[model samples]
Target: MRVGRELTIGTLSRRSGVNIETIRYYERIGLLPAPPRSQGGHRLYSGEHLERLVFIRRGRELGFTLDEIRDLLGLMVGKHTCGEVQTMALAHLDDIRAKIADLRRMERMLAATIARCQGGGRSECPILDALAGG
Candidate 1:
């Protein structure tokens, strides 16, 4: 869809599901380039802004850090081959696998703690005890 004319930060936020403050934060962190402002100093966003914001949000949803998203954006700006993108994706997949492994370990630990709870009262909750390193 053609996002015509200039869009205010609020409009961009609504359209992209990214918070207005987050857009500013991304600009501050260089993840998103600062856009031109209006005569009254209001930020003016265009279709490109919407597209890039969607890309950033999608990357974040896929478990990429801001730094990694920045790198991916940079790579996207160049004429990279499919092989290069595939390699980067494979690396990200490995990272996702590692995170899944860690989460599984945490789940197992939590399950064991829950199993240990005597279920008599809140004061004796094993989950709380485990969190307290007991």
Candidate 2:
């Protein structure tokens, strides 16, 4: 959080805990604005860049897709977007719930299949049978 003055790309990467390649890729994908260059052509990043990168990293960690992140960023210009943001968040939460349900189902199936396994040097495997759609 020592994000005061202009920083090099390396400094930004270290400060934000995001890789340099990811920073460049974010710039390429329009998630991040291109930073200005120094006299010698080295990219000079402002504190705002560091903040934005942190936001992006957190969004990614929270399972927000890049396009959804872009939407969030676009909505940051005004307070009127709170309702919209909430709607998007709810949709994402629903998707997460559905995925959790699927994962629980998978866990149950796997556990049941494993329980059926005797595993006494048997040539037949319940695991293989389940995998083979049996």
Candidate 3:
């Protein structure tokens, strides 16, 4: 979509790939600002709002939490340095790496448990036994 057009909520949703409900939720949560209303009480979002929504969607797609996005947005609105942004990003990267490590550990444990299962139908399943803490 072109960047200069004023948009309704629906149009902003389509343009930013965020749903209307999510847009309202973001507004409520202060991630997004409440847009002006038309004379008919319809929301009138600006291109700037559309851009901010797009930034939020992209941040979510990248797995940043809303708080992190809020901080980033705060930094962006201030006269902050790239060093500040990099510090936040590096901390987030460490969190992602830790989560990946934990998932890998879980994968190994699950695979080992499943591998120990001998496939006889009668009753004695190792998977179920393991899950039951036996």
Candidate 4:
């Protein structure tokens, strides 16, 4: 929340908990606005840029795709209602649930296959055999 006339990219990265390369990548990808440069061609970020980077980093941490983040940003700027946001969130939730279910299924299958292994030597390995189309 440090309001200032100018801040270096490093300072902004430290304040926002985002790396400098990521900030530049976001700018290049249009996720963040390109900041003005100093007389020596160094990037000068403002407090607004800092907050926007923080927002983007948080969105990434929350597992949102860049495209989804872009849509959310649009909603933030446009006439977005709670319903729209809720719908998007619910869709993401469904995707997460599906992935969790798939992972649970895989875990169960792996556990069953491993349980068939007795750790004895010279015996056919059930895990390897199962993996080898048995």
Which clashing pairs does model 2 show? none
Model 4 C-alpha lDDT per residue in residues 1-134, reported as the tens digit of each score: 75767989999989999988988899999999999998899999999998888888998897889999999999988998989999998998898899999999999999999998998785789999989989
Off by over 4 Å in 3: none
Q: What is the lDDT for 75 in model 1?
A: 86
User: What is the overall TM-score of model 4 with all chains considered together?
Assistant: 0.88
Query: TM-score for all predictions?
Result: 0.88, 0.91, 0.94, 0.88
Error of 3 at 56 (Å): 0.6
Q: How far is 109's C-alpha from truth in model 4 (Å)?
A: 1.4
Off by over 4 Å in 4: 120-123
Ranking by lDDT: 2, 3, 4, 1
**Model 1 deviation from native, Cα RMSD in Å:** 2.0
| Candidate 3 vs 4: which has more TM-score | 3
Ranking by TM-score: 3, 2, 4, 1
Local distance difference test scores for all models: 0.89, 0.93, 0.92, 0.91
Candidate 1 displacement at residue 63 in angstroms = 0.7
Residue range 1-134, candidate 2, lDDT tens digits: 54568999999999999999999999999899999999999999999999999999999998999999998988886565678999999999998899999999999989999999999898999999989998
All models, RMSD in angstroms: 2.0, 1.6, 1.4, 1.8
Which of the two, 1 or 2, has more TM-score?
A: 2
Over the full model, what C-alpha lDDT does candidate 2 score relative to the true structure? 0.93
Query: What tens digits encode model 1's per-residue C-alpha lDDT throughout 1-134?
Result: 56878888999999999999999999999888899998999899998898999899999999988988998898899988878878888999998999999999999998888889889746777788788888
